[model samples]
Target chain A: MSLVRLCLIMLALLALAAAVAILLGETPLSLGQYLQALTHPASPPGEVLWTIRAPRVAMAILVGGALGLAGATMQGLLRNPLADPGVLGVSAISGLGAALAIAGGLAAVPGAIELSALAGALVAGGAVVAIALRLREPEALILFGVAISAFGGALTALVFNLAPSPVAIAEILAWLMGSVENRDWTDSLRAIVPMAVGAALCLKAGRGLRMLTLGEEAARMSGLPMPRLRAYAVAGAALLTGAAVAGAGVIGFVGLAAPHMVRALVKDDPRRILWPSALAGALLLVVADLAARLAPTDQELKLGVVTALFGAPVFALLAWRAARSWRS
Target chain B: MTAAWTLNGVSARLNGKRALDAADLVAWPGEVVGVVGPNGAGKTSLLRAGLGLLPLTSGEARLSGQRLDQLTAAQRAGLVGYLPQDRRVAWNLPAEVVAGLGAIDLPEVQALILARDRLASVGAGDLATRGVLDMSGGERARVLLARLLCARAPLLVADEPIAGLDPDAQLLTLDLLRAEAARGAAVVVTLHDLSLAARCCDRVIVLDQGRVAAEGVPGVALASDVLARVFKLDGALVESPAGPVLAARRL
Candidate 1:
């Protein structure tokens, strides 16, 4: 299929999923109420649609698109198909920060925990980029990121272990499990703005990533600014991943799977894969969230858990295909 | 007259080892300068160091008479293009996409047009839409050549341009390089194939142990004794249907 056609299909799919998510939440809304709610925000049904479903849907879209775009950029930057937004450990670092805030009794404040997560993400991004500038090999870049990710994950767990009370522990654990439920407009804005900036930066760096398909030396020889490109790619991904984690709390699999799902449709152009991957991610997350809502269980399935259940198989498939043809 | 590209008393290091030392080479416009050496003799390093890809440890380099260090990357790119030794591409992108990457500053459509034109010039026009990863080594090499051509810079540096090819493909690449030189670009290439170098190049520079050992026309620079000492081999220039080729043997 043509890239344009595939992108349109992916966008249409995402829109359909989003419409379903918004129209059929805990309190199903008739088409009239859906339109009426938009017109009257103060009514009870309006509050459910606007305050509950709409924001949740928007949060899903923002988080999914951010992660998917970040993953595609990260993969292109590293020249590795196995890479994702979390490869640099930014998500875990942000989670650690948010967990620290929650355990420190900051969950009462609306945006304080997210602010902390953003701070942690920036610090981690700087540290990783500092290490990246000195490293001569891409393998070393991955190794450093993996190390930081492990360290962040361990520290977050430690924070969970040492929470002052059972309530703090539960809050931290819930935040870490990842979800987009019951989010408001303010919360979505917390992520949506930074994610937009991050997406723009990644898009601008797309051509450099395209040049990288020729190999590192050739790309550099082609006059690409290596350090700047590295910084932009890492920083942009950090912002996107940080925002996603802040809004939805460490959703995985979408970043790893969305790009791969649309990769064949785009002919392996890293830059070209960004938009389709974002659409794929948005679609994936909306559908997953819907599944979570409608599943026949006592408690709702966590968004992260559902993604992992499906993403692991995709991960295995990607690994299998990567071995067969690195290009494809 | 100012040379198209020049490296003066240049040296470079890789992995804490001296890969190039005080090597000097200058290629004028409208000429193919073949850099020939044994394995690890620093031919690649010389080209890289001179092109300012690898920074010089202790000397100077220039493109079109402009000091390389003073030139912005874009300015340098405007002056020259490079084709490194590795022919492997990291994606399954169409050949035109890969080729258009060289001219990315242009609008996408214009770049693809230039890339397709370059592909046709290299005789790989039919493969414009083919995925580079799916092509055979020879076909991919031609696509890479098209990418190099897409730059359309006046000074072209290609390392080991004819490595790992059938005789016909090797001849095709050589012909393309010569064609670029004929179009008034200064062509620099590295080759282990002495016969092909002697036949295709206007001048040949021989390197041994990180320094230029001999440089002149192929007949003198690759004269028998120089070949024996530097390359540890004996060689004789012989006439073939294609051209004069240097047939070499172990010492």
Candidate 2:
């Protein structure tokens, strides 16, 4: 299929999923009631749909798209199919930031938690790039990222250990579990600009990513500015990942699975994988969030928990297929 | 005309060891140059340095009478086409897409046409739409050769282009290189087959232990003494119907 047609199909599916997500939350509404509620803001059902569910759905789309695009860019830059945005420790650091905010009594303030998370993610991303400047090998860069991720995880644990109250610890733990629950328009607005900027940068770097598949030596021989391209891709991915982590908690597996899903449908060209991966990611998260809402448990499952439950099996299958093809 | 590519006293280090020690060579347009050496002889290093892909620890590499370092990336790409020793494609992209990567600035239609034409020139036209990873070793080599040809650069630097090919494919590859030379492009290739080098190259350069051990016409450069000292082979130049051939016995 043509890229345009495939993208259109994904967009349509995303719209359908978005509608389902908005209509089926704690206060379920029929299609007719949902439409009526959207049109009339005075009714309680209408107000609930517009003010609460709509923002959550929008957050899912934005955060999912950001993570998906970031993952595709990271995979292309590292030339590893398994690479994800979290592989560089950005998400873990973001988690640490949110933990700090909740532990410090700042969670009561709107946007404070998100701002802290974004700050932490940016710092982690910057450190990765600084280390990458000295290390030309992709393996070395990944190793450095792993070390940073471990450190961030330790810090998060430290925050948990030093919590002064059970309420603060519970809030931090719930936030770390990853969800778009209770998010409002303010969260979406805060994330959109950085998400858009990050997506644009990743899309622009597609050409360089295509050339990079030829390997570093061949890419240099082809006249590609390796250092500049690498820097741009890493920084752009970090931005998207940071923004997504700030908007939602550290949602796992969307970044890792979305691009691979798209690659199975389209060609493996890194340039071609970006937008499709983003759309697929949005769809995946929206559906996963809806499933979380509909689960039989009294309390809704966390978005991150639902994704990991589904995504890990899918990832294993992908790995198996890759290994099989390689053997043949 | 100025030499198409030149390396003057160029030295490079790889993994803290000298890979090219004060290597000096020149390749001119309309000539085919063969670099022959054993496993650690710095043939790959020479080609890489000549293409300005490797940083020279000292000395200079020049192309078209300009210092290599002075040229921008795009300019360097326009001047030299390089094929590294390893021919692995990490992704499963189509062969045509792989070849079209050489000239990404062109329109899609133009790049596709160029890629197809180059594949046909290398006798792998049917493999254009095939996945690179699915092809046999010989098929992959031909496709990669087409990619190298797609650059249409003034100087072509191919390291061990015919390493895994059968006899006929090997001859076809050599003939293709010679054709590129005849088209006024300087072609530099690394070869392990001394007989093929003797038959195909206009001039031969023999490297031993990261240095130029011998260089001149094939007969002079591949002299038995040089072969014995460098390759450690009991070999002699012999007359054959095709051209000069190397007949070797166990050392």
TM-scores, all models, native as reference = 0.92, 0.93
Docking category for candidate 2? medium
lDDT of 2 by residue, B33-78 (tens): 9999999899988888777767799989998788998998888888
Cand. 2 TM to true fold: 0.93
Interface DockQ per candidate: 0.67, 0.68
* Best by the TM-score measure: 2
Question: How do the residues B1-251 of candidate 1 rate in per-residue lDDT, one tens digit apiece?
Answer: 67999999999998799999899999999999999998989998898888777878998999999999998777888889899887778778999999988885689999999999999998999999999989998999999999998888999899888889999999999999999999999999999888888999999999998999999999998898888889888778888897887777788
True contacts kept of 1: 0.67
Candidate lDDT values, in order: 0.86, 0.86
- Model 1 CA deviation exceeding 4 Å by range: A1-8, A28-41, A108-111, A122-148, A224-226, B239-241, B244-248
Put down candidate 1 lDDT per residue, A91-207, tens digits, no spaces.
789999899999998888878887888888878877876775466555577678889889999999899788889999888888888998888888877778889888988888887
